[model samples]
Target: MGQASFACDPAQTRGRRVAEEESAFRSCFQRDRDRIIHSSAFRRLKHKTQVFVEHEGDFYRTRLTHSIEVAQVARTISGALGLNTDLTEAVALAHDLGHTPFGHTGEDALNALMQPYGGFDHNAQTVRIVTELEKHYADFDGLNLTWDTLEGIAKHNGPVGDPVPYALAAYNALHDLELHSHAGAEAQVAALSDDVAYTNHDLHDGLRAGLFTEDQIAALPIIGAAYGEVDARYPGLEPYRRRHEALRRVFGAMVADLIDTSRDALAGSGCAGAQAIRDLGRPVIAFSDRLRGDLKEIRAFLFQRMYRAPSVMAQREKVTKVVEDLFPLYMSDPGLLPGRWQRDVAQAATDAALARFVADYIAGMTDRFALQEHARLTGTHVLGDLT
Candidate 1:
């Protein structure tokens, strides 16, 4: 029998066996772990933002660091709970593959530009990246990732609608929808792990940025208690080393608490095995009452000090303006798009196809590429060689 700790039914891969020649130390999940490590999207993370831009400070967190933290937290919790560490690490690593250059600001801009089209969502875009965008095999267009990984990416947020029917469903009745929605527990864990990673690490980054001080952070009881716990556990490390390790420990505690709380809550509710139980729709964090209260305070701290800080807000507004102005220009002059886009626009196909193509062209851009495109189309700013 297949390993049963994780959620995705192993049968779904249709016995498409992982080759035996692959590393003996690697389980199916480990193979997936390696696949994600080798992806180009994974590398682009170094250039992406977490909270502060990478160029802003030497100590600031970038998207790459953020992913590493998420993987670290997820692996810890999965190891504790006897879940598949490799799978959790893979999911966390690939989670933000679709995030744009300027962090959420960039994503927001793209979403507005593509709103008339199928609307932009980083999570949804991540699915597209693995399934269609990352051109690898000549026979298969994208990374031929297992359905488990796709499910984790697609339904990580919990249940939305019915699982889309898969191929050959009910004798062609479900032909149009070739894949089932992957609203499973593993997916939910991936989503929750992302929350755990950011909520804690963002605070750490803010502190590093001098946007908030440790005393300010310690004002929140949950964080304060978590910090104390770490200090008590690791008493002999150097002061600087202790503080850094303490932050990671705090993140771990939060994740562990949330996972335990969530698992118990779901189990007690008689919804343990039901697919819908895992897809919580909104950003649900399974924490205790006290922890929940403290986390809100933490979020408030970020909103006031980090997200709404004058420097960050100024950049956010600039991104909004660039995206807003440039989108109309592209729509008006479809010729400005790449040759493939030009032909598609000329054909005037169904709106869905048109929208998908527009999204594709827009989503594939690097930060500098988007900026240059904005400048070229709107003539508001001059282009530079330094992307």
Candidate 2:
């Protein structure tokens, strides 16, 4: 039940960028988690996209709900693997802080627009937000998170090979995140938790959106078996209940495989400390090959049936246009920007610097706010009769 030696211990934390007195009642990771939960960016996630835009439906997963689910999954995985749950939870919660309003669609659009500049990456934007953009504290421009949390956020997916995104690269120049190595145990757990949460909920959202039927997904691998098991247990269960039961089981299957496979790997790997886990140059947390294959099938099905479906594609185009419209509009006329943004706009040395600031403003917008701004500026309705 106790934390493993390979878990990151907050007491020996590498400390924040701007050193401060440690909290008497909280670990550094706990403070990081608390700061993230209370940040302005975190509050804006309620209107950001997951699979669908925020206004698509009340029941569909928003970025905020998806983050909470990922944090929940991370804690469960971290607890079972004897990793630091608080650190895992913090990384999980902060993982999507840089996502744009309309989700990947908006990001894709913004990236294309900024291609002449240094390109936009959600991961790099996340580093920018925590280390620079967030400006609540009097002492620092950004949240002065512990070195461990920043490292986890910088490369939770793995080593940041050549050509790292601009924001991450810039920050690493100031405070190195050890970009060539894997993140520590808790971060690895958070990354896998993101996979587990999104894969499961995308199915749930697809079903609820009526993009695909439960019977159709019942043909998929792990999901079909889950559906079959539910039918055997309760023959006449209602439709929604049946769907929920089967999907919950599918979720359990992913979490369990990750825990079981990862625990075996950890127990055998001889990683005596968190650094050893990072130094191993491979993922210590992962689903078994069978589950991975099953998940592949599920993901392919969802890609074809939900993500690229006609209705979703229509919505994607609309939001993409909104971002496309907003970016150049702001660039051509920084005068249109609010008074607070004007000082920064005036300070921009070059078009590239100005573009980065514009991207930052656009990236911070929520879906509804983006829509409102697009309407306000362009005087054109982007989301037309979107469900």
For 233-266, candidate 1 gives per-residue lDDT tens digits of 8777686576677676677677768777765655
Model 2, global lDDT: 0.92
Stretches off by above 4 angstroms in model 1 are: 1-28, 161-182, 226-246, 262-285, 334-352, 372-387
Q: What are the clashing pairs of model 1?
A: 158-279, 158-280, 159-279, 164-181
Over the stretch 79-113, how does candidate 2's per-residue lDDT look in tens digits? 99999999999999999999998899999999999
TM-scores, all models, native as reference: 0.77, 0.98
lDDT of 1: 0.64
Name the weakest run of 10 consecutive residues (lDDT summed) in model 2.
378-387
Model 1: residue 220 alpha-carbon error in angstroms: 1.3
Candidate maximizing TM-score: 2
